[model samples]
Target: MARRMVIIGGGAAGIGAAGAAKAAAPSAEVIVYTAFEDVGYSPCGIPYVHGKEIPDFTSLFLAEKQAYADAGIDVRYETTVLGFDPESRTVQVEGEGPSGYDALIIATGFDYKPPGVPGEDLGGLYYVKNIRRAMEWDKILDNVRHAVVVEASPLGLEMVTALAHRGIDTHVIDPHPWALGELCDPDIVAPVQESWAEMGVTTHWDTRLLGFTGDREGHVRTVATTDGELPAELVVVATHKVANNALAVAAGLRTGSTGGLVVDDHMRTSAPHVWAAGDVCEIPHGVGGLPLQGLTGSHAYAQGKVAGTNAAGGERAYQPVYVPWGMVAGTWMIGGAALGEVAATALGVPHVVGKATGISRARYFPGVRPVTVKLLAEPRTLRLIGAQMVGGEGIKERADFLALAVRKGITLHDLASMENVYSPPIGALNEPIVTAAQAGVST
Candidate 1:
């Protein structure tokens, strides 16, 4: 009998795992089980489609079912895996009988974090976790006049902008002191916050949702927030997500402290012939090897490759995660990597901060954009631990450089001394990083 590989979930991670496993072991039969209808589509683009940035909902889909078939992979849609038998190396599906596999991969993804309050099950309550749920928003947005989003992450801001663009009188309620509180520092987010009113969005900071009231039809009508009641026709819970570890936990696999599957560096679970990856995973971060979740498609895809390769009788180690994430909010861009001051402090590290503000291009250049750079360092060793940037067109490349620097433990002075290119039409004469590092050195 040929080797058989079964993968759970059909998101980016599962799809990548299917393809990689097939490629690594050509003779093996690869099967992917997904509860969702679509696979390999970008979840990050869900907001853009809702905001009408994209033409239609179908545009977000990556490929059709035939595409997977052509690649010699079987994708089972709307199929739920109920149980796993480690001794038999098989999985129990909803309708189908036990499917034997030589190896199993669990890329079960994540579920939306819901507000712990009553009436959340009401008709108007929605969530923006995956593209499938986002599609429902486009269909139902026509009837919504007032929409309230609960949370203040990048996705929350994006949903706020989308609802505002639709003239829905959007209001955002966040427990954080400021907007995009997790990604950018308050100083970097000030200008963006000030522009909320102009964009027709209301900002409610340091506020929590108490509960919700529904009409006779059980549709959310009034939102009960800490400050006061707001008339709301629609409510979106655009908050963080927890791992989708139902199948993993049921299979008696070990879980991490962070509530993700405890996988080895190669993405192997404790169960025999089983591997796990994607948003359902906890990965190593920094030199400390601390387990953290970097909820980006890039991270999922990379981890899936390792899981698939190893499941197919190949050896591949997962690299230490230097997660680089960013978002474009209105006209401003925010990005970060590794340990920020908040994370470092929680980790009990003695840390210092460095900050610099400059223009993206030469002072005299046309279309010069404002840039802010902040670096976090270990005071004793002077090692760059984290970098955050809020600025214009050029912030991403600079953030990427700093991410690598943090990964390699480069010192602030070393970065300042490194050679950089500058041009009148291209970039600033003095790199923003040099100034930020110089600021770090001064501390």
Candidate 2:
């Protein structure tokens, strides 16, 4: 008999696992169960849909139900996996029918936590974490004339841009002193705040939302913050996310200190014959050994591939090699443990270097924006340990290259002598990465 593998959560990770498993074991039966109505829709594109940058929300779906069926994968929609049984090696699924499997893969992804404030459950409050919420937001935003977003992360910034683009009076509130507080230094963040102002997104920095006030209809009317109350027709909370590991925890699967499912290099959970991937699993960072800040489609696909291949009698380990790239409006931000003062503090390393801002392309380039680059290195050794960049367009890619260089322990002198492609329209004759390395060397 052919091996039967059951995968939960029909998002990017699950889909990739199903496809990869089928390829590894041609005779095996692969099944996918999803709680959502649509499978393989890009969760990252929710903000673009809100911003009306994408013409239609449906365009984000990489695969439909029919596509999965055509690929010989059984896709069970609206089906929820209640829990897993390690001894029986079966998953208890809810809705429609029950099933059994020889191997299991969990990829339930992540969930958002709203601010614990009174009247937050009002009708006008919103949180977008999935496709259903995104569609619901699209419908309600047609009637919303003003909106307030609480948080200043990339998602919060995206929400601000989306509301402002629709001509809605938008206000962004965050308790942090600046937007993307942990991702970029204060020097780099100042210009980003200016860009937000230019885009007409009002910001309330260093202010926390106390509660919400609702009308008789249970619709939010005003948000009460530590500073003052602001009138709002809609409220969006873009706070941090909690991993969806309830099933894993219930099944006695090991989880990380950070609450994500703990898996091995091969993506296998503590339970034999069971594996986990995507946002639910705490994967390694690209540069340092630190856990990734969050999950992305690229990581999910890679993790799923390794998990499925190993489960199919093949030996494969998931080796992560890329950092996450976050884009808000036109601005790009990349995060990784590139030996900055903050990162060195987190890793308990003594490092110091100077930071600089320059153009990725020539100053004459029409669309060029200031790129802030911070370099971290051992003062005595002069070895580059980390680097971070924030700007528009090509900045994220440049930051990624720097992250790799740091991971390889590239020296400041080697980096300063590095070669890069340059064009007046594309990049500067002296790349910011090299320039930043030279700056560190001089320091």
Candidate 3:
């Protein structure tokens, strides 16, 4: 009998899993089910689209339905999987009926979460996470002269930049003093705030949104926050998302502390033949073994591969999750892990931070952007635990090196002694990582 593989969700994770499963067992019948019209589109690019960096909404997609069919995989679009019976190994799809499966892969990612405040259901409120934002937001986005964005995540700042670029009076509000709160340290944050001010982005630090008020037409007009009320035409909320785990919870799968499905390295759930991936599952943190949500697109695809491969009778394990991320907002660019003094204090780890700035190119070379590097190390062992930076470019790549160092438990001395490839047109001869490493060791 041919094995049957059923995948729920058509996001990056689900798509990656589907491909891997088919490759692992060509004779197996593979099916991918999603409730969305478009499949394999990048969610991370939504902010860029809203910012007008992307040319069109259609450009975000990776493949079309024909491509999936040509590969001998079944893609059931606009299909919602409501429930599954583990005993019968069957899944019930909306309007399509129930189907039996030998193995099940659940990649139903994050849900659209609202900022738990009053009057959130009002009109003119937009969410960057929703797919409809890309397909339909254009009709109303033109009228948004003044936009109030409520969020604490780094993506919120991205939205602030996108909205500000559209010549809208953009105001970003959060209860925290700095944006990218846990990711970037104060050293990187200071320059960011100054840049935000220069970009005409009003920052409402240490303020929380209490409620929202609208005009007679029921369109959101006034932003009533803890600080005060401000006039607004539109409100965009880009807050953190909760995992979509209703199916897993109903199916009696064990959930981790991260509020996502608990899975081993192979991404297998508590059930005998069930697997979960993407934001709906939790992976271990690189620094500490604590299970944390792997919310990035890169993570979703990679983890999905592991889950799918294993479910298809192949052995593959997911890797430790670390974010080698960068964001360009307006004229400001930020890179690195953003875990420095604050993270160490919160985690109760005795740590020291070393900071240094190196030019992106030689002094004589043109386009010499300043790259800042902050290295966090254990005071006792001098092991690199985290790093943060703010630079024009070529910084996040350097942060990836540090991320590897953190993964390998590399010592500061080891990093400082490593040879840094430097060219006059690219960066300083010394390299910021080695400089930061030396500084961290001395501290």
Candidate 4:
């Protein structure tokens, strides 16, 4: 009999694992089970569809159900896995009996952290997940006049912009002093915050949600915050994403402080013949070796590849992560990699900061815009530890490069003298990254 590989969840990580496992062992039996009705779609695109930036939700799908079937992969949708026993090497499906497997991969992903306030169970409260429900909610948003987002998290920021794009009166409430304060420093985030204000979005900074009040229909009508009560017709809880690890914990898998499953360099769990990936598992940060979770879909898929390849009896090692994140806030593009000033201070990592404001193109260029770069380095060795950037066209590229530079142990001296492209339209003569590093070197 061929070896059987069972994967739980059909999100990015699970899909990645299935594909890689099938490729590693062509004759192996690969099966995937997902509680959701759909698979092979980008969850990251959900907010865009809601914002009408994309024409429809169907465009979010990368592949159809038939595509998986044609690849000789059995994808069981809307089928929940009740539990699994590592000792028995069996997975218990909700309706089906136990299915034996030679190897197992758990990529159960994340669930929204509950608001934990009163009236959370009321209607008109939304947690953005499940494409099917988003499709349904997209229609309802057309009629919503006022919406309040619970936090200023990444998803919260996306939802805020989406709602604003729909011309709805949007309000964002957060305990943080500024948007994305947990990640980017205040100065880097200031322009984005201004952009939100220009969009007619109201921000309640340093304010906590007290509770909600509903109308006769049990739908949210008012948002009560420490600041005051705001009339609201809808509420979105976009708080931190907690790992959905009930199944993993029940199966006796070790989990980290981040509530993500603990896995080795090979993505192997504590139990033999089992691996975990995606938002469900925590990996060490490249700089401080701190465990982190709730990362982007790209990270999930890469980790899945390592897990699947190893489960198929192949050799592959997953490396520590220097998470490079970038996104548009209102109209400003801002991003960072590894640690910023705030994060470094919070983590107690001693560092020096270099900052510079340079043009994205030559001074004579038509559409030149200011690009600000900030580099963080260890004070003694001047080794690059993290970076943050906000600009018009080059934020994402610079953030990605800095992540690699940090990984490779690039230092202030290296970037200060680094060469860059120079053109009238696309390239700038003075690279902000190099200038920022020079600032640090001079300091």
Candidate 5:
């Protein structure tokens, strides 16, 4: 009998798992089921498309549904999996009978946390997910003149920039004193906030959302905040990402403190012959083995590959995450790996810090931009615990290097002595990372 491999969800993780599973078990009956009508599109790029940075929504798709069929993997789009019976080893589909699976991979992604205030159900409110809905919203944005983003989250910031670029009066409301407060330190994000302010983005900081008010047509007309009422033709609810764990919970799978399915190194769930990946599962952090969830798409894909390979009777192991994250904030770029000062403090990890400001290219080079690097290390061993960088051009590369360095137990001394490229066009003679590490060593 051919082994049956069933995957739920069609996001990065689900698709990744399906491909790896088919490769590992050539003859396995692989099926991927998703509630969405479309697959293989980049949800991350939705913001850019809305901002008119991309030409069209069609450009975001990586592959068509027919392509999966050609690869011998069954993709059932617009199909929902209602529940799973762990004892019976079967999943109950919404419009089908119980389907048995030799192996199951649950990659159900995330849902935006609701604002949970009055008039949230009113029209003119948008939640940025599901590319189809985003496409519809993109059309609606053409006529919107005033908009308010309910949170200063990554998505919120992106939407703020997008709306402003379209000549709309953009407003951002956040109860926190600074943007991305949970992910970045206040000082590091100050410049990005300043740039947005310069761009004419009205920021309502330290203000709580009281509720939304609607017009006669039930479209949002005003955003009532702790400060006062602000005119808004639309509201973008860009709140926190919460794991969609209803299926996992119903199936009796054990979840971690982060409300994500508990999986070991092999991505195997508590149930036999079942695995979980992506936003639905919580993995340990490299810094202190703390459970972390709601990571980027690359992490989801990699976790899915491991889960799929293992579910197909192949051996694979996933390591703890040194999360490397980067994104353009207003005019500048910001990113970090592992812990930042904010995260370290929140997690109660003791650490010392070193930081430096250097040019991205040679000082005399044209288009040279300032790059700031901050390194955190254990006080005793000086081992690199985390790093954060904010700059014009080199944030991504530095973040990637520091992620690996943190994982490999590289110390401040190692980075300080590390050789770097010194080309005038792109390479800098003085690397900010090395300088930051040298400062750490001196401390």
Candidate 6:
């Protein structure tokens, strides 16, 4: 008899696992259970849908129902897996009905936590994490003239940008001194702040949202921050994310110190014949193997592949999870190691870095905007450790090269001597990567 492989959560990781498992064991039965109505929609595109960047909400679907069926993988939508039994190797799924599985893969992903401040449960308050929430907010956009966004992380910034594009009076409030505090340093952050300001997005820095005020109808009217109160027709809380690991915990699987399911290199959880992926799994830190770092789609997809392959009687080892390099808004692109302050301080690298705010292509190039690049290296070791870049165009690709350099432990001298294709219309004679490395070496 063919083995039965059950995968939970139809996000990036779950879908990838289902596909890989079917390929590895052609005779095996692969079934994916998703709580959402849609199976393979892109979570990252939620902001774009809100901004109308995507023409329609359905455009974010990565795969259609027929696509999964074509692969011979059974997809059960609107089915929530409540818990699992390790001894029986079965999962308790709720929605249409309860079901059982021989082997299970958990990839439930994460959810945003609205700030616990008063009036948070008001009608106008929102947090966009999935397609349903995005669609709901899309309708609310027509009624909202002003919106206040709490938190300025990537998701928060994206939502604020989308609101501003819709001509809504948008304000972003964050306790951090600058936006993307975890990704970029102060030098790189300044240009992004300036860009947001130029776009007419008001910012409240170094302040916390204390509470909210409501109108006579009990709808949120204004946001009360530590600084003051601001009028808002809608309030969005985008503070932080928590993994959906209740099923894994209920199955008697070991959880990480930070609350995610603890999995080994093979994506195997503490329970036998069970695995976890995506946001529910606490992947190892690239630098120090630390736990609790955020999980991205790329990491989830890779982990799922490993879990699926191994579950089909194949041997595969997943590599260490690293920080992702990708684009966000059209103008601003960030790429770097998402290292903790603890790691930075432990390295104790006294490196001198130079930054330049210039055009992406050339000053004469059309549609070019100001791009900033910051490089970090240890002068004594000459090893390039970190770099951050932000710009309107061509910054993301360049940052990828820098991230590669850091991952390979490339020295400043090596990067200085590296060759790069360049043209006045396309790129600089000395690329930002080379220039930044040379600057680090000189210092």
TM per candidate comes to 0.95, 0.93, 0.96, 0.98, 0.98, 0.93
Candidate 3 weakest ten by summed lDDT: 130-139
Model 4 misplaced regions, further than 4 Å: none
What local distance difference test score does each model get? 0.83, 0.78, 0.82, 0.93, 0.92, 0.76
**How much lDDT does candidate 2 score?**
0.78
The local lDDT score (0 to 100) that residue 145 gets in candidate 5 is 85
Give one digit per residue, the lDDT tens place, for model 6 in 40-143. Answer: 77878888878878888888888779998999999998876777788977677764354566678888887776588888778888877668877877998988
Q: Where's the lowest-lDDT run of ten residues in candidate 6?
A: 334-343
| Candidate 5 lDDT score at position 276 | 91
Residue 5's lDDT in candidate 3: 96
What's the C-alpha lDDT at position 342 in model 3? Answer: 79
Candidate 1 residue spans exceeding 4 A from truth? none
Instruction: Please give the lDDT score at residue 113 for candidate 1.
Output: 75
Over the stretch 1-443, how does candidate 2's per-residue lDDT look in tens digits?
Answer: 99999998887888888888988998899988888887888877888888898978888989667988888888988877888798888778775355678989988888776688899789888877678877877988888877899998768878888888887888989888877775655665666677778877789989988999999999999999987888998998888777888998998998887789888899999998999888898876655667763556778888888888877777889765545344654244444334446546767877767567778678887987667777778778777777666676576576567667766777888877899888988887777767877888887
User: Per-residue lDDT of 206-260 in model 4, one digit per residue for the tens?
Assistant: 9999999998989999999999998888898999989999999999999999999
Any runs in candidate 6 off by more than 4 Å, and if so which?
Answer: 95-99, 329-331, 338-343, 346-359
Task: Give the TM-score comparing model 5 with the true structure, all chains together.
Answer: 0.98
**Total clashes for model 3:** 2
For all the candidates, what are their Cα RMSDs to the real structure?
A: 1.7, 2.2, 1.6, 1.0, 1.1, 2.4
> How many Å off is the CA of 324 in candidate 6?
3.1
Write the residue-wise lDDT of candidate 3 on 1-443 in tens digits.
Answer: 99999999888899999999989998889999888876788878887887889877778878877999988789998888899888789999888678999999999998756677778878888876556566577556777888888864767878888887787888888888788776667678677678778878888889988988887888899899888887888888877767899998998888988789988999999988999999998888777776777468888999889988999999998777656777786576877752567777888878887888887778688787887888888888888888888887786687677777788888889988989777897767888888888887777
lDDT of 3 at 41: 86
Better of 2 and 5 by lDDT: 5
